[model samples]
Target chain A: MRLRFRQSLDDLKEKLLVMAGMAEQAIQRAIEAYRVRDTSICDLVDRGELAINRLEREIDQMALDLLAMEQPMAIDLRFILAVIKINADLERVGDAARSISDRVRELQAFPVADLPIDIPRMASLAGSMVRKALQAFIEADAQTAETVLSMDDSVDKLNGAAHYTLLTLMKKEPNLTPQALNALMISRSLERVADHATNISEDVIFWVRGADVRHKMGEKPATEKTGTRS
Target chain B: MRLRFRQSLDDLKEKLLVMAGMAEQAIQRAIEAYRVRDTSICDLVDRGELAINRLEREIDQMALDLLAMEQPMAIDLRFILAVIKINADLERVGDAARSISDRVRELQAFPVADLPIDIPRMASLAGSMVRKALQAFIEADAQTAETVLSMDDSVDKLNGAAHYTLLTLMKKEPNLTPQALNALMISRSLERVADHATNISEDVIFWVRGADVRHKMGEKPATEKTGTRS
Candidate 1:
């Protein structure tokens, strides 16, 4: 029974990593769609969303079944609960990808001038953070999770740059307002994806170290950074 | 032991409702601050964030504790999981409120001009949805949760209106681009609050009925409408 329970937990983790990969790919494709003005990539995002949604439901059911049947305790219980919360975050990250795809569709409908912003860079950072967070979860690597946390500030800086740049562009060339606004929305979506990644990393830390490092109210205890990368 | 477990779960639920109330008020005040261009109210939102963050941690810890201690099964397991998910959504709603407050501060920094759109109505709808979602959770009213789901479409409509109106205003009155963009961001924040509220309501339904109505792929038999108002 104990072995089966452990296997069930591992199975749930594997499925969550798969779902995370799907969300990350959707985000990557959505960014590419923005760069190439490719509506076909948006179609890919839309189709991929169905799979992500289905994965979310499957994971949720597996979690419920594990709880009902095995009655996991202590760290196991925390793991299941963390999976539920992380599942929601992953689903929202998928939604953010869909949001970006929708914005790309809007930009296609209304021909817009080129933006002087680093939107793809922002998306790339956010996507990397998401991928790293999942890898940390699969490997139970607290150091990688911490790295994901540190990258959040950089994503915020990018979002701020995107915001101010769009504001200035809108002021200078009012004709670019619609496209600039769409680009700003895209930046916001990427920022949210990064936030979700941070959430996943926090859960991984909790899972591995049995510590709650969220909200970051107190000074984090100084420790030599472990070189754990998966 | 079972009685103590039930009590702890109830306590967690009550605390969640209280946190939900605080977040709803913050969202309401943030909207008022935006409408009135009150920087002080915006500051209130900034200060109140710490409390919301702390409540989120507290609720999360409590949910995990209950799950570990009680090893709750079936509906009980679902209830604890729902609390964990709903707690995250509430914290995000607080973040949306803070975003609106930040926009209010930015708007106040600039010279006041004739507003380009109806933002308060959108904010109010978002706030009401948050409140009603909590009410649904407390009462286990799946119908009210469904109502919250339906209302999300209305918020989306308002967001579209806000965007189109602001885009036209920016095109017609190029000088108002900065202020118009700020208003657009504020409207986007309101739409996000509604989205979070819908997420909470969906969690409530999942807790009560064990049905995942999230992506609209699964059709569960609707429960009787518990028309309870909080």
Candidate 2:
């Protein structure tokens, strides 16, 4: 491997981390907006999305150029491919944050209800998953990625519970129907963020271990199921 | 440029088409189940998901092997990369179908309502998007892919209408809460299917013209916004 190619790879990773930071901040701000009914935070999320989208294109182009020029093989090849996949996930995470913010904007027009759903708690879990998944990607940690995968199930369960709670609330008080549905959509968006994080983690595992772990429910680690190619 | 590599690429594309067929079938079956309140079609969707998942793994492995082994450049590289992205989209399409089927199974337990939601029409539109997107991919037709992108807005509008109508129905008759909510969820799933189709079409355009058309809303075609690399 050439030193210049290694530097380019490092640069790609740095850009991806910057994009991840933007996405994480957007989610945090969106949740903060929801907590305090602050419409300004929603605006912040909307503004951040453009930068994230731009970074996505830059990172994708960089990775593609690396693959095309260097023609990297083995672990280097895997790393570039993983970066491409993670770049897509991070952009979608930003979109999810924007979606949550969209709901917050809608909720601002309606009366705030003391809903039974713990959306803040769900957002916190999802945020943690995003942070952990990015950490796994940075360090190429398969175990951390696996932990992120497990956390996805928890987030999913919370999303289901939130849906049920909102539905019950809407049924009891018809006036709260729109507000409850907005909350439900926000919960779903947060679940999608967690899902994108899980995808990044899966890509990390694939990068480190060269194993396809997706849709293999209850499957063992990459080494046990399919021997590492790297 | 090797004959064997070309044959391998052809084989990968064939597998992708087969997987696309399975995904399309799953969506069709799930919608049929919802329309007739048939639990059996839902069962078939559940069964079809396993095949889709397996095909996803096979396609990913094949694409990765090609990238690593052949190390092809130019259009071959783009084509393989596009296949990988489209493969992921198709699998998600399958998952969306399964989600709709899950809702259908729930609806089967409740009394069916002649709700104002045009879910069947939404499903048809979304299904055609998937088919046309795949056709664009097969032919590398940027025009068809652009058409698929434009159709996404319509599906989104229909999804919004479904949400509005279902919410109104639920508020008017609280007894229809669960059933209406299921219909609402099914509508959302179909919307997601359309989204995945749009993603596939975007990948098609990217592959055909070497232009990143994503996130360039309101922008003209590749020749106008960005010149073609091919």
Specify the highest-DockQ model's number. Answer: 1
Looking at chain B only, the TM-scores across the models are 0.89, 0.90
- Interface RMSD after interface superposition, each candidate: 12.1, 7.1
Give lDDT per model, in order. Answer: 0.83, 0.84
CAPRI docking class of candidate 1: acceptable
Q: Can you list the residue pairs that collide in candidate 1?
A: none
Q: In candidate 1, what are the lDDT values of residues B92-183, reduced to their tens digit?
A: 88899899898888777678878757888888889889989988998989999999999999999999988999888887787787788889
Tens digits of per-residue lDDT, candidate 2, A161-204, equal 99888888888988888888889989999999998999899889
| Each model's chain A TM-score | 0.88, 0.90
Model 1 residue B26 lDDT? Answer: 87
Model 1 alpha-carbon miss at residue A53, Å = 1.4
| Model 1: per-residue Cα lDDT at residue B141 | 91
TM-score of 2: 0.90
Question: In model 1, which runs have C-alpha deviations exceeding 4 angstroms?
Answer: A211-230, B211-230
How does chain B of model 2 score on TM-score?
0.90
